[model samples]
Target: MMPSDAPPPLPEDLFAAARQARTNAYAPYSRFKVGAAVRTADGRLFAGANMENAAYPQGQCAEANALGAMVSAVGGQRIIEVAVVGGREDDPQDLCTPCGGCRQRLREFGTETLLIHICGPDGRRHTTTLGVLLPLSFGPDNLDIV
Candidate 1:
C-alpha cells in the first residue's frame, strides 16, 4: 500500500506505461534499470528507459531518453510532469532523482513543473518542483544568440 500522501496515486495506465518502457532498458553494465514517463502540455505521455553502453560516458540517462522521446513525438511540446522509477525487480523506492543534466533539461521545458519520484512497492513518492531541483539554472534566457 502506498502512503496516504503519495500524490493521489498516478493513473494506473501512467504507471503501466512507465513499466513497459522499463522492460526495454539495455543495462548490461550496471544492471540498474530506470524508466521515465514525461507528460507533455498537449496531454501526450512519452516513456523511455535507460540505455547503457560499454563506454560509460556514452550511456544515456532515463530522463534524457524520455525527454527526447517527448520532443520527437510531440514536436517539442512543453513538458508538464515527469515521473521516474527504478529498481532491481521493478522496485520504485530504489528510484533516484534525476541528474544535473536532466534537471537542466527540465528547466528548459518547464522549470516549475512537478517531478514525481517513486521508490518501491509501497509507492513511496517524493515530489518537488523543477525550479527547486535546479536553482539558478541556465536556459534560453542565458544564451545570447544574436
Candidate 2:
C-alpha cells in the first residue's frame, strides 16, 4: 500500500499513457489489447500492456504488468491513480475494467480512495474508486505479521 492512505487528485495524462500502452499489447490469442497506467505517490507514471501466453493462465494482465513496472521503477510505490484501456483490436468495446484477480492485485498497492479509470477503445470512459469497486474485500492487512 501507499505510505499514506489519502492521495491527491490524478494527473492529466494518465489515460493517454494507458491508451498509448494499449497499442503495444501482446494478445495474439484473444486479440483483446489492454493497457494500464499507474501514478505513484511521488507522481511518477508507469505503464504496461497485457501479454498472453500459450499456456493459458501463464499470461499476465495489464494491471499486473503496470504494478510490476511501478515496483521495478522504485519498489512498491503506492498507486494513487490508475487508468485502464482495453478493447479488441478489430472492435473497440464499451467496457475495459480490471478482472477479478487484477482487482485484488491492485489492492495490494492501493488504498480505499485509489481512483480507477475504466476506458473503452472508442474513448468513452468511466471513473470510480477502489473502495466502491472492491468493497468488503481481503488485503495484506488481513495477514498476520511476524
Candidate 3:
C-alpha cells in the first residue's frame, strides 16, 4: 500500500507509448514533434502524434488525436489522465505542455481534476491537474444536454 500523501508513481507504459508516438509525428514546418496519450476511466489507453499541415492553423495536436482514438474506441468514456511529450525533432529532451486549444479539447471528455502528466525525452517530468491548467473553466456540465 502507498501512503496517501505520496504522489503516485509515473505510468511507464503511457510514457513509452507517448514517446513512441512522437516518432511518427509529421512536422515538416516547425520540426517540433509531439506525442500524447490518454487513459480512460475504464483503463483503456490511447496514443497519438502531432500532424502539421501546410497551413499552420490547420495542424492537429497530438492530444486531439489521442482523444479521437479514445472516442472512436469507446464513445462518451471519461478520460482519467493524460500524458504529453514534445520537443524538437533533433533534440527531444525539452519539456512540453498541452496548448490552450488542446486543454479545452481534453476538457470535453475529462473533469477539472483530471491529471495531466507532462513529459520529456527522459520520462515523466511533471504532473498537474486540468483545474490547475484551466482554472474556472466551463464544460458540458455547464450547459443543457440530452
Which structure among the candidates has the greatest TM-score?
3
Residue-level lDDT for 143 in candidate 1: 75
Model 1 misplacement above 4 A: 1-9, 88-93, 121-124, 141-146
Query: What residue pairs are clashing in model 3?
Result: none
Q: Estimate each model's TM-score.
A: 0.80, 0.84, 0.88
lDDT of 2 at 7: 40
- Ranked by lDDT from best down, the candidates are 3, 2, 1
As a TM-score, model 2 comes out at 0.84
Give the per-residue lDDT digits (tens) of candidate 2, residues 39-130.
Answer: 88888899999999999889999999999998887997677889898854454546778898988999888877888878766553567778
lDDT measured at residue 64 in model 3 versus the true structure, 0 to 100: 94
Candidate number achieving the greatest lDDT relative to the actual structure: 3
Better by TM-score, candidate 2 or 1: 2
Clashing pairs in 2: none
Query: Lowest summed lDDT over 10 consecutive residues: which window, candidate 1?
Result: 1-10
- Candidate 3: residue 5 Cα off by (Å): 6.9
The 0-to-1 C-alpha lDDT of every candidate, in the order given, reads 0.71, 0.82, 0.84
True-structure lDDT of candidate 3: 0.84
